[model samples]
Every structure is written in structure tokens, then in C-alpha cells.
Target: MSPALDVRRPALAHAPLLADPVAAALQAWVHADGVGVAAIDPDLADTAAFVEAYGVASDASANCVVVGGRRDGVERIAACVVLATTRADVNGIVRRALDVRKASFLPMDRAVELTGMEYGGITPIGLPADWLLLVDEAVTLAGRVIVGSGLRRSKIEVPGADLARLPRATVVPGLGRPVG
Candidate 1:
């Protein structure tokens, strides 16, 4: 069980609380032994509110942010998973990684449209196959982490090691830096 949540097995067990892609990913997860799901008030889905209301450690929460850039007129996109206590280094490391002249957070509508997920509820698990998934090394060492279920009404908990094994996931050291 999570520190303060009624975590249950098989994220697919709560299909109504997850986005279609999220549910599908859970269904196919090979190393899902420790993966769990927990329902939450939709309004508390944001990281800070969820942590304060549920008493989960900040470090145990991972936020997935979508970033995009263009290189030679071609668009490149990536999803970055970072611990809530820190922020992705988009302008520095991420920009260079994408080999783009500049990197910026994708607009909300575009992100939602591209990932088929609600705003504030985009998780790395079910991202589009073509997009890169960049996970912070810190997140991989965080034990169990709380990530979005692709819906504002629930969260998915999985061992950090399992996250690094997701398709297209690349563990990047220093991808996240402490937030000020």
C-alpha cells in the first residue's frame, strides 16, 4: 500500500479512472508485479495538492512534462519524467538532447491532443511510440513513484526500476535539477 493511499493491484482494475492509453499500457506491462493504482479526487490531481492532501513524500511523485523543439524545420518531441521536487532542464540538457535550436514546453492543447491525455495528467507510460521518453536517474532510484494515470481522478504507483524499462525510456542523469 502507498503511504496514504488505498493502492490496489492491476491498474487496469480501475479502468474508469485511467485514460485509454494508460489502461492499455498497464494491460501489457510485463513487469507489473509491483504496479498499483489509487483513486483520487480529480481536483487534487496536481502534484502539490495531492502531496499535501495525501501526505505522500514529494520525492515519491514524478511529473511527466512534454517538451518540443525544431531542428532544421523538423519537429522533435519528448516526454520528461522528473521528481516533483525538481524540474526538468529543458533549456539546457533537453535542448541539446533534442538537437534543436530551442526547447520549450509544448502548449497544453497540443500536448493533450498528441498524448490523448487530460491536461495535468500526462504520464510517460502510454506516450506515442515516436516520441522519446526521457526519465531522470533520480526517478529511477526513487523506489515507488506516483505518476498520473492519464486521468485527473487517479494515480499509478510503480517501482522506479519498472519505469526505466518502459518503451523508449532513456535514463538521463541530471535531467532534473532541484527547483528553487
Candidate 2:
């Protein structure tokens, strides 16, 4: 872990949300894969606030968005991860990638309910087994990145390559575009 990340936080296994299978899966993966975790104030969990408060570089932080669409009356969902300086191309790239006519950000309520994680705290580490995980290729190139820890109270610092190794994760070029 880099010096920028606080090492005082409890391991992911000890996090309060571990009782949830999604979170527990993340904890298990982090331990098994050797990722790092940092504690943060739940109140400042939003990306902008967390970055500003902690002096973390925005480029080193990643955001995960859940997108949903339907095809042939069957719903399709995916978790997209992009650097904070970029925006996931849900309507264009993602819709095409998912083979759905239209792809949009999942409703907050539905996302929170399905992922078993709080809004503003969703991470790709422990998504539902059946859901697709899309990671921007640039994210995989980032040496070390900060992402949600399945809870707003902490964050995980992981090598981008490690994130690419996630089961069901696909590294897609142009998955995200630079934000204006």
C-alpha cells in the first residue's frame, strides 16, 4: 500500500458490513488477493469529499456505477468502474457492450437493494455473481487505485491489475471518456 493510504483501518473481514455476503466476498477477495484497505468517515464517503478531505488524488480514485437494461424481457445488469476523472459511457459503449437497446444507471433504490451495499459506497469487489463487471482499460493501467470498500466507512487501495483479475470482469478500452 502506498503512503497516501491510511493503514490504521481494520481489515476488510472486520468491517461491520461483512455480515452481508457481498461485502464478505469482497473481504475474502481482498485478503486472498492482497489488496489494502483504509478507514474513512462515512459522512465523507462521497468521492469528491473523500478526495478533498483526505488529499487523495482524484485520478487515483475510481468510481463504480451500476447500469441496467433489458433484452427480450430479461434484465441485464453490470457494474462499471472508471477513474474519477472519467465518466462511464453507459448510453453508448455500455449499451452496446451489454447487447441491450438502452443502458442507464440503475435506480438508486434498486441498486442499493440488489447489491446489498449503500448508495455512494458500491464497489466492484463483491458484486452479484451473475452480473457482469466492466473495468475501463485505463483503470487496469493505474498503478494503484482507491475504490469503495462495500461500505461508506472505508475504502480499498488496490493495484489496478488486481482489479482486472476479478472474476467476470472484462477490461474494455474506451469504457469511459474523460469528463469535461
Candidate 3:
């Protein structure tokens, strides 16, 4: 295992299990389209947990990343991609690629308002039309993967190969190693 992955969010076993919005949004898509879908609830946000969430032997899960960028002097929000075992280097890749002066995580309220998904569930599937999406090469390697449901209560497992079918999504290698 990569040492980078070793520094993951520890599972608070006693902490109440919570809902995931990303999961819910993905499930909704599955039902509307009748696509085979499943949800992987992890006890923690660590790499190991995510790997377990997708039922992959290793880091096979895709990442549903959120980013905050300032465009035209206004703060805008976007989501990016990376392998679940990897992380989003938002400060470097997101900011430079988007040409934004300042980039940070979108505030909870703003993230919810823009994505129409509840906090913790933001997904790129039905994101704002103008919102920029930078899909990673690693994500496309997998036929299918799990992402945020736009709600913390659930997650959306979908076909990664067919992501471009959605309008206004640009597939690129914006995914990078996290600077955290």
C-alpha cells in the first residue's frame, strides 16, 4: 500500500452511521434508468474503507471530488476525479487548470445549492451545466465506479466509461496526487 494512503480518515466506530448524498443521487439515476447499482457504506473515509466500499481488492473505486474556485471574482464550485486510493490536488491542478485565482472547498450551502444534492452527496452526473468537470484518466480505466449521491445518506455507483454521454462534461486528466 502507498504510504500516502496510510494517512486516511480513521473510522469512528462509535460515531453514528450517517447518510451519504452521493450514494442517494447515484441510486436515483439507477432507478430512473434501470441500471444495476449498489451502495458501499464505509465506516471511515480512508483509502482502505473506500476500497472496501467498492468491493475492490485494492484502490479500484473512483473519487467524487469537490473543489471551490473563484471565477470572475465570484466563487464557483466544481467536482473532479481521481482513483479512490488517490486524492485530489485541488490547489495545484484545479486552480491552475481552471485558471482561478483562489480555490478552496465549496462551502456546504453553496455546494448543495449548486449541485442540488445535499451536503456530502455531490456528484458530477447532474452537476450545474456550467460547472467545469475534469475527469481523470484513472477513473476512465474502470468500467464502473461509485461516486457521491449529492447526499451523505447514499452513494451513486455508475458506469464510468459512459460518463461522456452526459452533456457539458469534459474528460481530462485533471486527477493528480493530493497535496494534503
Candidate 4:
């Protein structure tokens, strides 16, 4: 395990991917459905590089993006975008979509704390039930996409269509489309 993955979160479980409740639940959900998951020998923080380095199909890489939440003592919404060739123009789309007064990238600690997913490995699976899931339309084009297993060392390669089954996700246009 890389030293950077030592999230050392308080509520984190001592076990691997099952350490966090959300993570554990996520693993259980995928496993129960018999999701065909695979892991890479090397750790990948960058989704694009992970796809290239691991020979993971580009169309099938789900990048777990953590957009800022409505922090009025509650996380109203968090955007989990798929990993593709571009980035999410949060200011233009996410903010307007979530309808929050303001939207920005969540602090690392806050993101880790709220999502229960390790830094450099945040995935949409096993996140808080209340957090709104916004899936980019382009991601549905892939047959399989590698996503975080709520752990840094592990990732789950799941079918693009199946992602919605894990969580009631909301499909949004221009999630990765250029804002300008």
C-alpha cells in the first residue's frame, strides 16, 4: 500500500475496502450482483493515466469526481463524474444543476470524511444515500468502466449501465462538455 493512501480516518474500518460502512456496503452490493471486478497491480490516482497504464479501456473508465456540497450542516449534493478525456466544468454545470448557492471542490478532508472514499480513489459507489448522483451521458457509451472501490488499492470495473442500479443516479448533459 502506498503511504499516500493512509487516509487514517477516524470512522474508517481496519479492514481493506470493507473498512468504511459505505465502502463495505458498496462492495457487498456489487458482489451480490456478481459484478465482474478486477484490480491493477499498481496504484492509480489519476483516472486517465490509470486507464492508459493499466490498459483499461478508455470508454470504460469511470472517474469519481467529488464536487463541493451544500454545506449548511448537510451534504445536499455531490457530483460523481466518470473518468474520461476531459474534466467537469463544476462552476457552470454542477452549480446550476445542484441548485446550490455556491459550488466548488470539496476540501480533501471533507470529501474523504463525507464520501468515506479514500483520497486519490473517490468513487460514486457506496456514498451517502442522500448525496445526489449525476452521471455524464458519455459514460454510458462504455461497456465497462473502472471505478474506485472506496479504497485506494482496489478498484471495481463495472458495466456502465449497472452503475445506476447501485444508486439512483441522475443523468446530466454537459457533465464533461466544455463550459466555455
Instruction: Say which candidate scores most in lDDT.
Output: 1
The TM-score of predicted model 4 comes to: 0.76
> Could you tell me which 10 consecutive residues in candidate 3 have the lowest summed lDDT?
6-15
Find the number of clashing residue pairs for candidate 2: 0
Which regions of candidate 1 deviate over 4 angstroms?
1-4
lDDT of 1 by residue, 71-176 (tens): 8899999999999999999999899889998999999999999999998889998899999899999999999999998988889898887889999999999999
* Whole-model lDDT, model 2: 0.82
Model 3 lDDT, full chain set = 0.56
All candidates: CA RMSD (Å): 2.1, 3.1, 8.0, 6.5
lDDT values, one for every candidate: 0.90, 0.82, 0.56, 0.63
Residue pairs with colliding backbones in model 2 are none
- Kindly give the stretch of ten consecutive residues in candidate 4 with the minimal lDDT sum: 2-11
Tell me each candidate's TM-score.
0.95, 0.89, 0.67, 0.76
What is the Cα root-mean-square deviation between model 3 and the actual structure?
Answer: 8.0
Model 3 residue 122 CA deviation (Å) reads: 1.8
Q: Write the per-residue lDDT of candidate 4 for residues 1-180, one digit (tens) a residue.
A: 222222223112323543265446644674334343334443564675676666655556677787864746655566567646657768777887777777888888988888767777777767777777878877766666666666666666566676666566877766776323
Model 2: per-residue lDDT, tens digit, 93-128?
A: 899878999999999999989998888888888889
